[model samples]
Target: MIMDANTIKDELKKVGISINDIYDLVNTKESYPLAIPVLLDLLQKGIEDVKIKEGIIRALAVKEAIGKASPILIEEYHKIAKDKMMLRWAIGNTIYVTITENDVDSILQIVQDDENGMSRQMFVLALGKVKSEKAEDILIKLLDDEELTPHALEALGRLKSKKAKSKIEILTKHPKSLIKKEAEKALKKIG
Candidate 1:
């Protein structure tokens, strides 16, 4: 059954989460085990506000509820408008925080699409957290993307890509401290 806003609000209220607005339901701290289902329900079937959806995505992450929410989050990621930067960023972060082996291919697809732009940075980092040869290869190639070089360096490091070590070493001398630092860190991880 598709829950109306009032029904969703009532469900949250039963869990002591009194909210005057839907976006107010984005709670990061304090595990609301009772409210998770409601939030998930709302995320799946409730209002269409990108902000509220973004909030729900972030709240789910903070609650460590990604297992139940990951598929829905990925679906939402594809359905949302490209201009919804915050929500896109939230989904990327959710992937980063709760990445699993099953998600490697999906994450690779997202990162490969340059249309997703920098919003895919966290997804790049997520690739590093898992053991995937394809993901490692992609990260190595992404090192050429100036906007994403730091994230690519970090991911390649996490994968301990020996193939990327020489390229990463070059980045250590990059004038930008962030890139240089990421390059140095990746070298350590690769070692």
Candidate 2:
């Protein structure tokens, strides 16, 4: 069924139709286009529900509505300081969808402030999606972090950085098989 934003909003008001159900529907390509505008509207209303906010963010990313969603996501990021994982994932998805130079500094700041390894890893991967020299430098620095190195290497590979080639080669002999495999793949990508 082809639903407009108003119709979707009404459906959401129904008691049993939870946000997760909306999320599942919006995750599909056919439904995402219809869902994104409504999701953005809900976000704009300042919905306090964390799950709803996350669902909206994911819907925006899945629909590739970065241009329309980035500003709102950044605003939400600034407002949400306690939910580190959610913020990181939303930012990562935003970066992945739209690798703009304007967002690089903010993303770097988030990476610097976050102490969680997984959040840092997600942010590092997001940084790789940015096609800026600054992002490349940040990825290089993260290569020394044992916990983040594998993800960093993967991001560098995605960025296709020739400067990371030597370092990635060194990681090919890492004791951890996952790191070794990722490093080998990164080397190939760099080449």
Taken over the whole model, the C-alpha lDDT of each candidate is 0.79, 0.70
Q: Give the per-residue lDDT of model 2 (tens digit) for 18-105.
A: 4435466546645345455656667776755566566666667753575566666766766765546755566566556755667778
Which regions in candidate 1 have their CA more than 4 angstroms from the true location? Answer: 1-7, 14-28
**TM-score of model 2 relative to the true fold?**
0.77
lDDT of 1 by residue, 74-95 (tens): 7778887888766787898977
Q: In model 2, which regions exceed 4 Å deviation?
A: 1-8, 11-20, 31-37, 83-87
Look at candidate 2 and tell me the lDDT of residue 190: 84
Best by lDDT: 1
User: Global lDDT for candidate 2?
Assistant: 0.70
Question: What is the total number of backbone clashes in candidate 1?
Answer: 0
Most accurate candidate by TM-score? 1
